[model samples]
Target: MDKLTVPTMAELAAKGESPEILFWVGCAGSFDERAQKITRDICKILQHVGIKFAVLGTEESCTGDPAKRAGNEFLFQMQAMSNIQVLDGYNIKKIVTGCPHCFNTLRNEYPGLGGNYEVIHHSQLIQQLIDESKLKAEGGESFKGKKITFHDPCYLGRANNVYEAPRKALEILDADLVEMKRCKSNGLCCGAGGAQMFKEPEKGKKDINIERIDEALALNPNIVASSCPFCMTMLSDGVKNYNKEQEVKVLDIAEITARANGL
Candidate 1:
């Protein structure tokens, strides 16, 4: 892949220019090896569509989703306040996040603390691009005649009611879109939400992620598409447990979009 040119908020500000949107690279997108690929794909899509965007870079901090979910309200607020200070200083008005955890917190939870902004998940932005005919699915042949099943991130689907955007993005590829029994509002959790990812699972007949993957495998999809980093980790691990990693591949929506457009 060619090197990508992404600007930091400070760099753009120094030039007396402000980006139209802030690309919020959540903790996973910044540090997790697998998720960093999604981060780059998102940047490629933004640049391909000629959208002006900037990242906070080191100025970006965790959205405190884990802390809040772990019931550490005090720590969550401290981190949130610090981020709000930096974002407000930059005069950021619109944000597109790679992680649904960040999307939920920054969009829903922050406003109560006097930090309000137009926050959207990358899936929504991708849908918008496709709708405006900017992303014409020029390389959609990559996914043509393939079977795909999308795993809805809990925060993106149930919590925020963003069900159509991601499917619309996939629909443009002309692939056979299959739906799991527990999709849409009834989507199952990948067992990584609510701070569960940081600890061992409690006693159960089966892990939640395994069960979720079982549902997807039932459809025999070529690609298990997701829009969240946490879900990506869990689903990929589940596929490994069933010894089906070779046959089934896990991918993010942004990655699929970037690849389809040859970005």
Candidate 2:
């Protein structure tokens, strides 16, 4: 991976003269091309509706979630302090992050480390935009051709109580939506959260995500959509490993919305 370094929030504030919003694209979304595209699409939609936001780019470093979860308090404190200094410099009080891990860390954990900000997940912002009529899907061009299901990220759903925005977004697309036997607050981990993204999972009976893929496929859905980049990456790998290509797809909620809007 590239060296993990980020701008202090002050440096970012200096760059944007007067930024209207701080867009926090987490490590996964920043490193993964597909995730980046979805993030860009969301930014476009927000911009179309006059939401002035500044992309933090490489300046928004890891939220230290992996370190903290791994019990490496030293590394976690270093990362957290660096990020706090950056945020303090920028005078940023509000942040929008695409990754639920980042969202949870910033919103819930940061205050203890002297970083306080109002953090909102991308899904929440998208739902708001749609509700205000700033974002709309074209009517009738439903994913009538395929069936799909949504996977709830633990941080976004159980930890933060944000279970409906993403599902609502999918419902608008008119896709054949099915619920996983374990969903919403009861959703299973894709084996990618809680810093699982940075480490190898212990060998087990089966991969958590693969099990999820099987469940989604059991419903015969052509696509499995989710809000978290980590979940998307894991589930996509699960589908590929299972040799379910051509039979199913994995998509981010923003990508689904973009398609529904005919963008």
Tally clashing residue pairs in candidate 2.
6
Please list the C-alpha lDDT of all candidates, in the order they appear: 0.95, 0.80
After TM-score superposition, what is the CA distance of residue 22 in candidate 2 from its true location, in Å?
Answer: 0.8
lDDT of 2 at 109: 90
> How does each model score on TM-score?
0.98, 0.90
Superposed Cα deviation of residue 253, candidate 2 (Å): 0.8
Query: In order, how many clashes per candidate?
Result: 0, 6
Candidate 2, residues 1-263, lDDT tens digits: the string is 12223343455466766566788888777878878777766666555566667766666788888888888888888988899887777778889888888999899999998999989998888888788877777732468656889999999999999999988787767668899899988898888887788777898998888888888788888889898988988888988997987888888888777777755
Q: Model 2 off-target regions past 4 Å?
A: 1-16, 139-141
lDDT of 1 by residue, 100-153 (tens): 999999999999998999999999999998899988678534899889999999
Provide the global lDDT of candidate 2 against the true structure: 0.80
**Collision pairs in model 1:** none
